[model samples]
Target chain A: MNSPLITRFIFLFVFLSLINAQDKNGYFSLENRLKFGNFLFCKGDYIRAIDEYNFVLTKQNNDTLKFKIALAYQKLERYDESENSFKELFTSQQFGSEAKFEYFKTLYLSDKFETMHKRIADDSFIESSISDKLKRLYNLKHLYSSKSIEDSSKFFQPFNQNESIELLKFYVRKQNLDNKSPALAAVLSAIIPGLGKVYTENYGDGITAFLLTGVLTFLAIDNFNADHNFRGWLFTTLAAYFYAGNIYGSAASAVLFNANVRMNFDSDLTLFLNKNNHFSSNSNLFCK
Target chain B: MKKYIYILILFFCSVSFSNDELARQYEYADKLFNDQNYFEAITEFKRLSFFDEKNVYAYESNYKIGIAYKYGGFYDNSVFYLSHAIRTTENIDERIQAEFQIVRCNILRKTTDRALQLLSQMEKDSVYSNHQNEIHYWKGWSYMISDRWDSAAESFANISDDHELKILSEQVSNDKYSVTFARVISYILPGAGQFYTGNYLSGLMSLAWNVLWGYLTINSFIENRAFDGVAIGSLLWLRFYRGNIQNAEKLAVQKNIEIANTALLYLMENYRGEKP
Candidate 1:
């Protein structure tokens, strides 16, 4: 057989090799950890799944693995972490169109619509992979949320003519420009008690404000002539203030009412669009 | 394989054991607190504190127990637990809150002397001096309850620059004067005092009615209409003069009440000051 010293050396070498292999096997292997994370994610134990996925990320160096980490964070409602991961993947270029799409989705979900719009505006290549319908929706949302109505209208021009009309109407109403028209009406009515309200489409209130103020003023004047100076002055002052305040208040009320009407219209339009569109759309789509 | 399986089972079991126990206790306590079953929540927290003496939540539990007692109107019990929380807790916020509650408990128990002493100490402390306005407000109330009107007025006047409390203090002080003014004005020119004190229309009406009756009585007497003069003078003129004086007093009183109400409304709706 072999010499005793050589035999002992060989045994020791094998034992050391076995120990090294066991050490390499890891406390929890990357693959096993990922599997555990996925299992937890599927079972809706998102918090634990995120922990496992994070553990895998420390040992693993793969884009797909990173994507899974982001998905896990998303599942856990750790939106800030998920958005950062998606943003990293989007910039890497290796992750391709799917990564870009997911990045946009994460940004949208996090209410980072402005950044999503900038990405779409800067990268022409993003449009080729994402559907035309999706692009339209994203653009619409971006426009709707944008402060500039003119810019929003320009973005919405390609979708529907009716949408343009509706948007302009909304813009006017939101800006409270409806008050200008009602103010004119109120001024006209002030010239004659119920006339301004008729012009403003509030015949009832205008008539009431006018009649009450007119009667009070007449009574006050009559009382003054009859030598009831105190009573006369009291009613006269009350009438004057009420009449002036009514004119100013009516204009303001009309503007507020129009703003409410415009808000309602936009809501109805959004609901209609959502019902007709089959692809799941986001509320931000109206922003564009 | 069997060995690995056994290791995994042990790990899972250990995790479940600690996590499940902690979560169950947390949820049970939360539910009890939410349901306003504060008494039961205190017991659970006590159990938790017993199990884990170093747990920070034990301080919270003690504080909450004091709060529950305070809300239940058990001022003595509130003071005891709140004092315990203040002495035992390391958290500055919790300690400050507990100290405040202890002071509040003393006030509720009508131990104003102790409450005032504690408030004075707090006023001296740089950390709690910012709460002096509230302290003075309560002190004023305590003084009022003790029938120390002048002291109450002084305390109220100290913070009268505070929009709401100033008005309240003014009303309390004004009530004393309103009663005096109404009686004094009635003793003066029948209704001239009422007019000077802001009852214009009523004062003029009183004066006019009284003078007319007086004039008619005098005119009849001068015309040698003795029977008519006596009847008018004794009945109409005398009755009107007395009626004018009474009206003046009533109007003055009413005006004072209106002023108090106006000040009260200002305190309730517009004053930015601290309230009881």
Candidate 2:
């Protein structure tokens, strides 16, 4: 009889202990889970961190956690998800300004400048506290994109005077890019076998082209003078191939040169902006 | 007497409570893993590893994290976590399981040298004597991934003579074109190498080009036009001759890649055996 009674007591104790476990501040509790999510967020494991945050959100409404989920998506480069998450907190009193600012930043980072520009044009959507920061991001978007900016004064309105001068240089550089024309290169090469390559700064290839064409042409004329008709015809064909090939090659070189100039300018602008933190708020503010 | 019984029950509950909680956490993470939610499963397993302060779930949590990362194609992270599993466990079988997984990750990531090194080390160990066939299997796979078909055949032969992988490796080795033979033959006979590599059209074209240019240069020399001979010999005849050799070498290499990739594709798609 006592053995049966002990078994029952053991079962009862396990059952009651499990109930207490649920009520206690254990690992699965809402509070403990929130803390764990924050820890994961800080540890740079944002994908897993989002899972923890979403779990906590299912149980309660917390603006800070919501903001964190958006920021984590941004870090993961899941911009669409980040945009939707930030959109949810647009009306939040505490995180509303930060969410609005981060939402535009997400769009900017996603390279959706057109959409971001349209959104920024709506002054009603802008929050007062983060308006200046949003304006800075808006102007930076223009510099990063291919869309032309007309009004210099309006484009530089949000930056400091010193910063404005620096940005103007970038703006001017973008507008007056040193791009060589493929048509002009082809025409020049047609006039002289290697002149286009020389104009495009490909001196080694230009010199080789000049020497190859000059030698082949001289050989064709000399063979004809010596009554070597077969060799003369062969040299003429070879010269024609080289001449046409050099013209086509010079046009390609010009196009490649222009692409490199554009690529260099874009990379330089990106490097400068990254070095200056995009002239806006630091992206690390959410974690703090 | 009742108070003494109550104290014993309370002490038992406290002791078992932490264990049960850790076990429950492990079960939840395992469930997520079974559901194919790998990212969340990793987080939960990490959480279990964090709170199981007595290390009750250490080996299990680490091993599962490794498997989850493997499933997610994160070979580097899989090796890292599986190494943790190997270190945490004292059981020989469990250690071997983790070690095998690390080897698999290395093979999958194309770090064949590392994979072969680990397999060799396992082969030398008395503790892994029972896993000889498994070691040979992975070593064969490592060789296969590196396109060393002959070595792969030799390694798989250590498992059994007629094993499917061994046979496949042998077939691949037999079917491959010899790059050196192709190059040497093309040097002797202008397009013979291309014909040997099964490029009949290219072979005919190359032979025609070489013959036409060769005759023109020799005839020019016979006609006492030394400049014509020099120009044709250096420019036309030599260019076609060198191009024949290069084409033969390139075709042989290309054919070999095709042969190896076909067998590897078959293994990936049709082989019912476990793979890295």
Best by DockQ: 2
lDDT per residue for candidate 2 within A159-182, as digits (tens), equals 889888878889998878787888
Candidate 1 segments whose C-alpha is farther than 4 A from its true place: A1-52, A61-83, A91-95, A105-117, A131-134, A142-186, A193-200, A269-288, B1-276
Worst 10-residue lDDT window for candidate 1 chain B reads B45-54
| Per-residue lDDT of model 1, residues A150-239, tens digit only | 555455544556655655554554444343467676677578766666666777887777776776687577657767575467567768
Query: All candidates' lDDT scores?
Result: 0.62, 0.88
Residue pairs with backbone overlap in model 2: none
Q: What docking grade does candidate 1 earn?
A: incorrect
